[model samples]
Target: MSSDLFDDVFTLEDRFYTEGYNQGVQDGARAGRIEGRSFGMEKGFEKFLESGRIASKSLVWANRLPKNPQPGGASDEKCSEACTLPPLPKNPRLEKNIKLAYALVEPDTLSTENSDEAVQDFDDRVKRAQGKVKIIEKMLS
Candidate 1:
């Protein structure tokens, strides 16, 4: 009878332990998912913000490019007065770099999905755009 009692006690302890372990596992899984999602969202926002900044800079550079005055056409005196900034010099290399940078971060071309392939492509394009921007800055300076 004593041995049977001891066995029942041991069995009860084992059952409680198993239940506790299972509960812990479930809770851990839930917490992990929440944390992962939060991290992903933060990183995605940062990447998009950086890309947007680069794209805007490229657009401003493109707009500042000198306009070719057509023969017998009226000069854009109003534009010159409104835009206090001088036009960028006409350089093929500079123009190419500006266009490439803009294309790299174009919203329509970039994917917003969180898939691995999409993330990798986004990162690659942003990196390449950053390099191009640096080169363009050096050239301008």
Candidate 2:
């Protein structure tokens, strides 16, 4: 082939390669955003469920214990009504859970840029925090 023709072909190939790469990058970013959104939604559901479980689980066991009785009604514990309830943050597990849950809910933390690996990092942290929360809950229970 002629030199001019060869040069033209190389230029076109380079342009096509560049365009493909740019498109791929754009697609990856978009995909990451969509995936991250779905993931965050799932995490929100999980947080709600876990929070409910943490708030209610201890109460389950606590209630099962025998209650004091008066002549007519169950005897009230001497402690204040609020004090007798489960502790806030549910427990130590819930402390970590609240931390992670708040982090997940924050908008900035859910970034999905293609080159940033935000999705992977967010997912990893969430999984790790969840595992830790479960372990803590088991210990508490």
Candidate 3:
């Protein structure tokens, strides 16, 4: 009777152990995916920042030209003046929207406590940027 009691007491249940291990694995995978997605978004935001700077510069240069550029009708001197400025590959509104998006991505003035609001603001800025991109596309075509 003592041997039987000892055997039963010392026996381990593999099922519970396996369940715990599997749960841990699932939890780890979920954590890893969340971290990976956040990292990827940060890297992408950095790239967008660089592009935004370039587009902003281009828009500033284009602003040197007359609001209405008559390419064929403008005089030689006027054309020369316009030619000195950088060509506008995209709409100025698009560049402005991109700048706004860049600012929203990581604003230095925003506090950690307002992170949720900042995220909502960022989403709105991104939507505006997307709309501006569509407008630029239409203008180009």
Highest lDDT: give the candidate number.
1
**lDDT (0-100) at residue 7 of candidate 1?**
93
Candidate 3 residue pairs that clash: none
Model 2 segments more than 4 A misplaced: 1-5, 69-141
Model 3, position 75: C-alpha lDDT score: 53
Point to the candidate with the largest TM-score.
Answer: 1
Pairs in steric clash, model 1: none
lDDT-wise, the better of 1 and 2 is 1
What are the models' TM-scores?
A: 0.87, 0.44, 0.44
Angstrom error at residue 138, model 1 = 1.1
Whole-structure CA lDDT of model 1: 0.93
Which order, best to worst by TM-score?
1, 2, 3
* Per-residue lDDT over 1-141 for candidate 3, one digit per residue giving the tens place of the 0 to 100 score: 888887745655666688899999999999999999899688657655744554464355445433454588765575556566654564566555444544443345323333668556544655565565555546545
Provide the lDDT at 105 for model 1.
Answer: 98
lDDT of 3: 0.57
Task: Give the deviation of candidate 2 from the true structure as CA RMSD.
Answer: 9.8
Backbone steric clashes in candidate 1, count: 0
Worst 10 residues of 3 by lDDT: 105-114
